[model samples]
Target chain A: MSESAAPGIDTAFPLSPEMRAAIIAHARREAPRECCGIIAGRDGAPVRVYPTTNIAEGNRFYEIDPKELADLEFRELPNENAEIVAIYHSHPASPAYPSRTDVELAFWPEAVYLICSLEDPDKPYIRGFTIRDGQIAEVTLPA
Target chain B: MASESTVQVLIPTPLRRFTDGESRVEVSGATVGDALDALEARFPGIDERVRDDSGQIRRFVNLFVNGQNVRDRDGIATPLSPGDELGIIPAMAGGSAA
Candidate 1:
């Protein structure tokens, strides 16, 4: 499945324990307000997590710092021989699913969107999806 | 009063198809609207994506000039310099289900 990636969603995306922990930690740290970040890595697998500032007002919206995203997209990611494998955001009060806004603003059809849900707080749920155009497909993200 | 001077427009990933995969394009215009008109002339269907039926910028779409929001300036009438950068950012509202 890795050799032949489909046009949109990858079949499987396994997250590392450390990265998962870090993502959850970040979500907890920014509780009540949503946190957003990106995972950069080689090939199709992510190597590191990049936490970015959510410049949008309120908890229901997130606009990544354009300069930071641009630098990573144009310079840093290229220098590391990597691309933004996944973009992650936390759902502070909702389920681990893409909202209407997420579906609408999914610019990268190729990258996986990892949404961490802190609805339960104690039992945080992290799910991954591929959002292409206006359609969404859930992918298996076993950690 | 649009001139032949070229202003760079930063096209986001989703709209690359209209640009033939070019993330950035140079178009001539005196104001934001003129540049967009030039872009629409070059790329047939992009105007509809950027604007609405009333020719107003879609609420979810944000156009930035020189790293500043056009809404904060003069909307489509925002003046442009020869080397100004215009960026298109579709608003990404976050996780909480509403």
Candidate 2:
């Protein structure tokens, strides 16, 4: 029930080069199908990117396996004093922007949404945003 | 019939607002549905977020009892035991292309 206080212009999605590379690698590895994951963070900065299974049954959508998400949210991240700061998914062949489906299914308003686009195959574009109350606002993904 | 048992429900961060910031709360219920009803009794409007208008568990909202999905068991009818743990996990779903 989080309201419209989605992270705005000030909040920084500091994705490290290594983590960025890992996401791109996951996207490429998953290929035609979409890849999904979450970034664990502490104090508002990203610490790790965990590649999760996309159990959506097709390539056009992604749904992180509930078991994995529960483990992270309930056990893993808590022990580290970290939380999921960002959620990432691959577009496969579309641009690095949130599609209508992404906006609609975004229930976690606190976590920044990162979309990695493999439109060109060779060049994967990654962008970050916050979707809350059906409104989308781009957030800076500090390279 | 099993008596109502007190169990711990884990409230994820996203739903913590409705829980008044309490990550975990103890509720007594014979089944998952009863526990949720008890939760809603304490935190108004939270049940709607987990269940649809027909009172069915939402597609994207997953309820797990001690790491086991309730859907795999008896769904909302899944019985609870004393000190059982229920986890409400909002599925992280969606994709960029269409």
Candidate 3:
């Protein structure tokens, strides 16, 4: 399928263990409140994980800082010839799934959405999905 | 009066569908609003995603000129310079389970 074949859903992209560990670590550090970040990739594969600030008013939601996003898009990513392959956020007390609010705010239809659930602090569960036009489809991750 | 200037608007990933998969587009305007108007004229249906019904920049969309946020400047009224870079970035946001 073409890159834009399905909009925001990469049907064949896989994640690395290091990257998964990074996300899990971030979720643990920001426990009780949501943590969020970006997975930068080059040539359809991940190269870096940017642990971004969650600027929302409360723990129930997450909004990345605009300045950090600007720098990543205009400078870092361009310099590295990388793009945002996925966007990951944590759910301190919920399941590893897209919430109703997540589906509603999933504006980047081309980005894989990764959700890390800290519901079981001892075993953080991570899952991936693609949300477009208020629809959600699960994507198997961590290959 | 300042002359209208040509600037490049960087289209983020999500809005690329409206921009024909283009990452950057050139437009002319004296201010950010004018540039946005030109962009919409060239690529229909994009204005609504970036701005609200009231013509205000959507709360979740960030408009930056030369890496400086318009919100920190003069909002839509932020002035543009020749060869300036404007970026339309959708805020990365979401929440937990239902």
Candidate 4:
């Protein structure tokens, strides 16, 4: 059977403008340190950007905020149109790229991983990725 | 005495131009805060990116020592040892709708 013909299979898609703005704003607000959040969308268009605190608190590394993640997951069940399409984070002190842990933790093959670097503050660099089982591939961000 | 561990402090892209494209820099410090201080001292003007106007750590940025968040351990006082890598990631916001 073809991949598309398989049952119980789901495919993830891209991000949208509103979602993009939310991530960017969060980054700017948290300038200097990295900020991270989630994006929900359907059919390749991002619908919402749920901002979450790094909870790394003052740490330079990023771990998804447990409360925020729980809240998002809760919200997802109610909103049929919303599904996690991307997981975004910023590199306040680094580049718009993934580190070793980033690669290792990315288990969602269908979800896009978005990263932004706030080195410039005025002009942050954003990049997208597809990480699956230790493999990494670059994805296109919405212009 | 300070711990004998040495790790590479990764600098962000925007600041890389100032550091001459240096992505990872080697520094020796016992704590995460100390290593950050060393980074700023060497880079100059880089501290502005990590701290707010009042000199406190900005809310959006996160510093990770060995995949663990500094906030859970000791904030800036998180200890570090040799072979530990520091990942500095910033929070980002997109353009406004209005």
* Highest DockQ scorer: 2
Q: Write the per-residue lDDT of candidate 2 for residues A1-143, one digit (tens) a residue.
A: 35433344225677889999999999999989999999998877678889998899878989999999999999999999988888999999899888999988998988889899999988898999888878888888776
In angstroms, the error of model 3 at A109 is 0.8
Residues A1-143, model 4: lDDT tens digits = 11111122233334556666777888888866677887766554566777777756453666676445533543342356555667788877667877776775553445677887776777876888766656777776647
Scored against the true structure, residue A79 in model 2 reaches a CA lDDT of: 92
**Winner by DockQ between candidate 4 and candidate 2:** 2
* Per-residue lDDT of model 1, residues A79-100, tens digit only: 7877667788999889999998
Candidate 1 CAPRI level: acceptable
The TM-score values for the models, in the order shown, are 0.81, 0.95, 0.94, 0.51
Task: Record all residue pairs in model 1 with backbone atoms less than 3 Å apart, i.e. clashing.
Answer: none
Q: Give the runs in model 2 whose Cα sits over 4 Å from its true position.
A: A1-10
- Model 4 sits at a Cα RMSD from the real structure of 15.2
Ranking by TM-score: 2, 3, 1, 4
Across B1-98, the per-residue lDDT of candidate 3 in tens digits comes to 76899999999878887888898999999999999999999999999999999999998999999999999999999999999999998999988746
Docking class of 3: medium
lDDT (CA) for every model shown?
Answer: 0.79, 0.89, 0.87, 0.64
Error of 3 at B6 (Å): 0.8
